[model samples]
Target: MVQNGQVFKILVVDDEMSMRELLEILLLKHGYDVRCAESGSSGIEAIRSDPPDLVITDIRMEPVNGIEVLKKCKAVSPRTIVIMISAYASTELAVEAMNEGAYDYFPKPFNNEELLSVISNALRNRGEEQSVSDSREGLLYFGCLIGESAPMLKVYETIQRVAKTGSNVVITGESGTGKELVARAIHRQSARRDRPLVIVNCGGVPENLVESELFGYRKGAFTGAASDRKGLVEAARGGTLFLDEIGELTPVLQVKLLRLVQDKTIKMVGGTEEIPVDVRIISATNRDLERMVMEKTFREDLYYRLNVLHIRVPPLRDRREDIPVLARYFLSKFTKDLGKEIHKVSSYAMDILCNYEFPGNVRELEHIIERGVAMESSRIILPDSLTLSMHRRKEQERTVPAVRSEIPIENFDLDKHMAEIERRMLQQALSQAGGVKLKAARLLGISFRSFRYRLLKHELATEDELKEE
Candidate 1:
């Protein structure tokens, strides 16, 4: 009733024609476009005819149960959400329906109000999802913040819980870890979602103009202020203002920002009038704000104000298991963007990516995929497609004597060929570096950290321990 077709286009499927008609009449009277199907086969046919936005079908129906209908809908037109209804919504039936992709299930003689509310909420969420899907460029980030690590799961759960609230959020993570994504996601899910979401890089803005940029400027505010200009805060009214690198804000700017948070008002530069504003603040910083506060560079009070809710994005190395998922996602994105035919990564290439510690996190992985898509000739991507600097470092590591403790061949009877290669490589690296462990690691093209791990794993002795012996 509020908006036509803007709401869910619903199809009512049931063995009883009376039930179908009653549902259709009830929904249509309330301003929903409703259709009726008396049998499972008919419902499936109607779905194939033109998929409805939502399907409400009875479970335990003749010929095809709700599960079959749900599965067919999922396979045929996955976007159409399915809701199951039955005379008895037993646990088993509900589970089966849900497992087969039913969005929800209602028992016969449903509580009409609850059913309506549930339907409305589902429809609203579906609308939100569709809107997000449209905005997703080539690459997509759910929660915009990417991570599949256990630590990241906690972060995702927190985002979902806190996004609906109007409270401020402070995101902390190393650089290139997608802090902006988290801020954007919170804005997209917030009450002010319909409003504009603006971003300001606090570190890059000049100290003298930071205040003016954040809180508008009058025509005569400064030498370059030719006309009245709205600041990011005013522009982001009723929405969110993301402040990146908050640790870089000058002491003077910090006080002003804190005032805005406390009073929900901003005074344009060189203007006496105070403008009442409603803007949610989402701040992020890679720097140690706590340490900065200790050094008196940042105000402790301001830190507390921005830290209302905190979400930390983990480094990509910590979530190696998600590398392939992200890689494939990016590959598909770039393939379409670059118009390349590359479809997949070779297993060996995948192994290299998973094991490598991605210092630049998701952003770096995206670049690698983009590069691979450009360089790949075969339909499948190979390791050479990625200019992974780390692999060169790995080979250098394999050459170090400290890479593995030298076990006398007789002392460490091992696979003949593998042991022979290990001894020869170690000896060559030692000879090349004059047996200097640090130099040996460098010649081997590996970091001391990586060499250390390999040495211990291989039960190889370090030259330092050998000298002590």
Candidate 2:
């Protein structure tokens, strides 16, 4: 590989001498043209003097920081890829770096294999970006999703590979992560593109009616069965059946679904006939089905059958690099749809979007952009037009008074006190919402997943507690 003349020049910037030496040795062993800088100032100078293909910089440095280095690199060499590293990594710092155009971020004491993989990916992506730039085309878009971020590129690759296969697929991700869009993409790319793509919201169906909804029922099957009805499975013959929120299927429904998945046939309610169906199964869930299987809530056989091929859609916060492109894409789409004259998003608005932790993922971002487009009177969207949840969070944060008590700082346990206060507030919210998690989350002005995570963190609600509510 080294003789093939594909080596990439890499620059490592760290305040510690040992770190610089270690990274240089590691990169050199891998047949790379490696350079090292012991300070952020020197790294900036080197970048301006002779830009490398990639720069690996420590976030915490003297006189200048990694964020500054990343800014300088972007300004001097727009094509150069920069990866930020730090022993002290926070969501805020990571968001800042990504918004400032860092290629990726990694915490200190990183795994060798993972770092190597990231470096290889960064080099490969640099080539792809250069090619796109040469052609004057925008970011690579697959179906409804538009992104050139590494995570999104991987997702696109996976979709292309799996689309041609007949294997069952399980798409896992947080809610509003476009799991359905992925299912549609797979169907559009598959051999069954011309055929029906039936979507069944598994959670929306009533438990008592799920069986009949999935399997056709005879005219006299039940009290309300005035006419015979074909089920979602039969409707999707020779096509794809996308089961959204598969985890919501009860144990009995899971067993029935498992049998259908295993046999490719369904038996209708009050019907002795076993109707064969030719369809691909693609299921999506936001819940942890593995834990559910272990807990005996979901069937293990069903889980395995649905998980023949898995695609995980990464949450939006993890792929902040794609926010600008996505925001622009949404802006264009909504403008045309709504017949607005909006042409672009202001840099300040884009920065706000990039810094936000989108608990609702891509769907939330799209909604925000749509709202912004609708609200904006001018061609450009400003920061005020973009009403994000983070703004609400900031307002809420400002309302809380500072710690003012007759207690010494050394003797006071501020963290513990805050935890107790949070726990009590959550409990009160749940009580006020009548133990409904969604309502409680809304009452708290937070996302349901965020509320659920806090509930898990504080051990506030057991499975049984949730069920009872």
Global lDDT of each candidate: 0.74, 0.80
Tens-place lDDT digits, model 1, residues 303-341: 888888888888777777678778888888899998877
Task: Assess candidate 1 and give its TM-score to the true structure.
Answer: 0.54
TM-score list, all predictions: 0.54, 0.57
Off by over 4 Å in 2: 1-140, 392-469
Model 2 Cα lDDT, one tens digit per residue, 1-469: 0433677888999999888988988889988899898889999999999999899999999889999999999999998988888888554676577677776667778777668876785577565565675353335445476777899889999999999898999999988878998999999999999999998887633454567778878888865566787888999999999999999897878877877899888888878888888889999999998999999899888889999999999988788988877887888789999998776575445656777777678888899999998987666676667774546431233222234455542324688667767777787787677556798899999999889888877876546434433
Which candidate leads the pack in TM-score? 2
Model 1: residues with Cα > 4 Å off, grouped in runs? 1-147, 392-469
Q: Locate the minimum summed-lDDT window of 10 residues in model 1.
A: 393-402
